[model samples]
Target: MSTIDAQTDSDATDVASRSNYELIIEPRKGLQLFDWKELVAYRDLFRFLIWRQIKVRYAQSAIGIGWAIIQPLFSMLVFTIIFGNLAKVDSDGAPYALFSLAALLPWTYFSNAITDGVQSLVSEANMLRKIYFPRLMLPLSAVAAKLVDFGIAAVMMVVMMIVFQYPPSIQIVALPLAIIVMLITASGVSVWLTALAVQYRDIKHGMNFLVQLLMYASPVVYAASIIPEKYRLLYAINPMVGVIESFRAAILGTTSIPWDLLGVGFLSGTILLITGLAFFRSKEKIFADVA
Candidate 1:
């Protein structure tokens, strides 16, 4: 009987060891990262979120999508007055209104994405508590939905170029890359803002101020050529500098590629994108509860 009992105990211990080895070990809290596969699994939800955001934005608005054109047109007039006439800001020899409008197109998309994306989770807290989907989807959808507005603004840019009798330069080929940088930057900022906004409601109030400050700091009204060569590289760290400058370079045929601007913008955009995604994923688990 002792021999049989010993053999049975050895068998039980072996089974337990096997079970332990088979069990999947998940990381502890705060170490979690984005799960791309899970997001892919919920792809339909992502589409629905994008559609929902679009519908919500335009449903009751009187001007509807027309606001996209009007916003840039009004901004162009203001910039033409303040920057062109009052401040005597140079537009690289192009019309001040056209130059400002070209820059404003991408900038508007980015600004709106940050503003709307930050509030997305808080605004949809009820849906969050009731259902389980990738929380990142909220901000991502908000940014994507705004692309329609960007498209409209882009169309307006083309029209303005034609109206000004501006012909496309060979460098126009680079415009796609420029727009990609804008998207990445916008999404990156959205990630950070969304994560931070969840915990600090103060972000809601300060976000507008920060964006306005950023706009002035960017070369939106003035030409990038006006900045001193020594400071240009440092200034390019603001990704918008590269974007606005490059757009002008492409459309107006005035400046070069702004390689220095491109370098800083690309590096900063990449770093922000990585860090922002990590930050968003780290806190996503608690978003439903706190938002």
Candidate 2:
């Protein structure tokens, strides 16, 4: 056989023997919505990013995960003194420490998630440039990493509840739902802030102040009952309001479930998630270029 024919036959045999695997790349046109299928296909990358975030979070830190418990625990103490004692803030009949800690758990998670998620892209700029993967994974992993901290801090909250003699009640059944709401809310805000942070670095600088304001705006140190009845619905528009209130009710066993407020929070959080996903996906194409 001719050398050229033999080479052609060899190439054909190699192609036929290889397993069928194909990847296509195309220039995206217009706004790209969230593609769960693509995200699922890249699940390994997502898991790796999450693991990297968790490792980086505790790396070189002497105390490591202990920082998680310390942050909210100390914040709860200061709030207990200033708001619980000095200002005489009401806690809906629950002990001030327990009340504040309940709210702080979700708040700390939300705030850290946003703060880290916002910087996830910028911080991983080298990876962003070196390889191609779902840009959403960076921010999503950042938010997910906070769950570890949240879990650690939660143990302290349980210990605090025991110290305060607060027992979980039927409302505790809704704790998972409340936590989902918080995650959705935090993920929405994180994606939005992360997309923006890619273009404007100033977003990172303003985050601390923004988080502080949001905490005060939320029911962290004070009870939702303190808000007048008329403005209660308006207050519920803030997603954290319902989340924090629900946590207090579930963990501290204080008030009954606030279905109306929770509904409002769900609605607002849904809107944020949709809009934030749209914005993030829209900006995703340019991330490598910008980052």
Best by TM-score: 2
Number of colliding residue pairs in model 1: 0
Give the alpha carbon lDDT tens digit for every residue of 1-291 in model 2: 999999999999899878566779787777666778989999998999899889988999999888998999899999999989999988888888888898999999999999999999999999999988889999999999899999999999989878877787778998998999999999999999999999999999999899999988998888889889999999999999999999888887788988878889988998998899999988887898998
How would you encode candidate 1's per-residue C-alpha lDDT over 1-291 as one tens digit per residue? 699999999999999988887567565466445778989999999999999998988899999999888888899999899989999887887888888987898889989999999999999999989987889899999999999999999898888888888887899888888888898888899999999999999999899899999998988888878888899889998888898888888777787777679778988987888999989887877888888
Candidate closest to the true structure, highest lDDT: 2
Clashing residue pair totals per candidate (backbone < 3 A):
0, 0
Give the per-residue Cα lDDT of candidate 1 at 59.
92
lDDT of 2 at 86: 96
Candidate 2's TM-score reads 0.92
Give candidates' CA RMSD values in order: 6.6, 3.0
